[model samples]
Target: MSGMHAATHRRSGDPQPVPPSAGRPNARTTVTRLLCVGAHVDPAFANAVVKECIGEVADTDRFVAPSYGYDVLPVLGHALIARNRRRYRRTAILISPFVPVLLSFLGMTATIIGIALWLWATWAAVFLERLITLHTLVAHLVVPAPEGGRHGFDGRIPDHAALTQIECDRINREQDGSSGLVYYSGYRPFVGAGTWQTSSAFPILLNRANDGILPPMDDRRSPGRAEVAPFTTAEIMGYIQRRLTAVLQAEEWEGQRIEELEIARRWYRTAIGRVRPVSPKDAPLPTEQGVEHYDAAREYLCVRVGSWDQEVVASVFVNLDVRGRTLYTETHRYELRPIKAAYHEVDRLPTAISPSDVRLVAAKAVVQMAGEAIGAAVTICTFPYHLLLRALSRNRPVSPRDQNEFGAEFPARRADVLDYGARRSVREIGQAPGAHHFFQDMDVKKYGDIVQKRVSELVIDFLEERNLDTGEYRARQATILNQGIIQTGSGRIVNTGRLAVGENASA
Candidate 1:
């Protein structure tokens, strides 16, 4: 039979049971006894060890023992009275026969006080440290923007009392009795003096209603009041790392980079100037002498005009051998002229037109006169000079078919109808080569667009992936706590007779 059944039978007086072979306690009884013994022995051992350690008192120990031993008792009696004393006197020292006995009591008292103070200091330091370091680290890692940043609730007290019954019920269903308290202290404009606020109190209390003890709302000045829930270093570090990762994955930064690249590309395109062919030479000059005299002199001799009188026109020409190429061909002529002006009139012209004003003026007049005459001749001429210029400027290449039929078309001889026809045919076949293809044409926009789009998508994806709702909840808690602390500290609610009648009056 099972032990439980056997025990039940004996309890009901159904049969006389034999004694167990060994006198051993049950599991529950054994564990209970062991725990009791351990609890008693642990303190005994610790006390013995502490006594042994402080037995050898040095000079520094002598000073501290006397001062600390006396101060501890009075301070324990009344902290305000001890604080007023400030210094320990020899008369206040406690004396005893057994050195160990005296030292043990003193050491224990000192240790307790030191431990309490240290614990209080550590708790306060941790609160401030967490506030500063956590906020700083998260801000730097996340790089939150004016537009996008992590926001959350801060758990605190008065916030706990403000929750509605339904909201409390909902919180109980979600959180398994786990809650947090967050306190924030800062300057507030509405509050005459600085104050601290507590948030997340309502949710925390609701969660705690089912299980877990809610920590006491302690004064900032009290030792036991500053209790914080224990958390491992690894857990804190993990939280920081996660927050940082979320910030780095945002889309705004990626868009900014893409915008920068586009701006650079635009500036680059503007910096590159356009390309064009060099300008053409001016028109040719006309003959100055009578037409009959110039035409006859040109066939017989290589006649040339040195200069022309201002009132009379002069002419120049040259004859060339048919077999040998002439340096100055009759088809293409060159001429130079000089102008004479009165000495006093030179100042009326441009001050710095040229070093030699007379020669400069003459050359300028001759070129102007030649340009007018040539322009008139070309206008009246049957040659298609304008068409030739237009074709050259277009830079159209001659086609293979045109080359086979008409050899090559020359710009200077385009006046020949045959050449002009051949050139026109060549141009018609070739067509102007299409606009230059560039490296940027290979859908460069695709790369930048993809990067920017993916970055944006990833940012949205990341935000959706995390629990932003929780963060917002936490932020609300923080804000409520902050406001509550300010209201409480600012003395906004007055008690009867708290203020003078003349100072202020309200119904």
Candidate 2:
């Protein structure tokens, strides 16, 4: 992740560990496959598409799994499983009695009575320990330390094999069959777990000055006609990559030295409705091999921008399709919001754990601990039931036929199987808005515009090189480049080459 600054120069190579997927939460029932998160987590109700595009991320897969914000899973797991060791040990001892009763029918009544007594005591003890641990840690981790004005909370999480195993298992079970490898290479969705933002599309007709629009496929019947064209679509794409990378990596301004600006080929998975009429019966292909040959709808030149120390990430996916005499190009952007305010509270914590701070935290946590104690009991008691459910439940399979139906695969069942859109933002889960500066938002917009504009210019260049008339393209390009966000009573109107008037309107 620290090496992100070089992403632009080393575009072809892996820059960081492939991001890890937070194990999908367990299925609620045999029929239901996903958790219904409230508006707090995912305000947009994004189609929950799979985030792991390259299939399972192995430990050896080198690429940064940039976390948009704080992930409570690791912290909570470490705190409850590793720190609360004594309590779990006692719980095991208590549950041991039930094992004997179930296995051997000897002294069943006596064993049942003994089990009941031990269970109650163990449950009470675990509840108390868990409650106190949660409260105390919250206080110590949140409260201001004695020495430093800034909180002393440590971000470093020590390596623990068990924690890693738990996280991997949880993520795999929930993310089963959501891999891009299972679908057409061009249908790979955005891999980052973030929110969709603004987008832009530019379609240019490739016709020379004197010659009117020419049907690209008109020569199919006349094999004698030479395939004379200005330039192949791939050549234009190569030009854009080279030119865009140069522009981004240029040292022309301050606060513009980007840490992560990755430009590479990625399969751009669009909604089922947006997917072009590609064959559904064809076997899926690996995206890296050569998805460019697939429909333009699925392949894209993804430009990733990681700013504010990777706290804010914006991805611009550019797709270029040359069909007949028309060059169809579109750019879709996605943004990952900042970490939650609560995680930032660590800034207010003391530099070191002090006796006085500990005592104070313990005192403040007492009331909250009481309530959490009850929750702990329930969780422990229902462990068997939940375990059983997980054992019996199967992760639904994604149907290839469903891809042909517009919005058909988007229903609950299919979405649960394939949609991996982010449900909750990091800020919502942490119970606080991101502590982002106004400048950060401005920077995000600036970067997106810079890359998008460059892309448009390169397309024009491609046409120019072929001696094609650039009049229409230039006119549309000027309008598209003159994009502005106008605020209205209803909401914000984004004006581009094509005016999108709705409050929710995006390119």
lDDT of each residue in 447-476, candidate 2, tens digit only: 777777777777777677666778887787
Question: Model 2 misses residue 324 by how many Å?
Answer: 0.8
Which candidate achieves the best TM-score against the true structure?
Answer: 2
C-alpha RMSD values across all candidates: 57.5, 12.9
RMSD of 2: 12.9
Residue 494: error of model 2 in Å? 10
lDDT of 1 by residue, 1-507 (tens): 011111111111111211232233232222222221221223332222222212123211110011100111111111111121211211111111122333456788765665454333333333332233223222221112233333111111011111334433322222111111101111211110011111112221111111234333763434333233333323322343344234333425636522211100000000011221111111112222112431111121111112111111011111222211101112111111111111112123331224364454444544444443334335535348777888786766755644545576556423222100000110011111121223222222233234323323332233233311133324433453233223347678634222335542421
User: What TM-score goes with each of the models?
Assistant: 0.11, 0.53
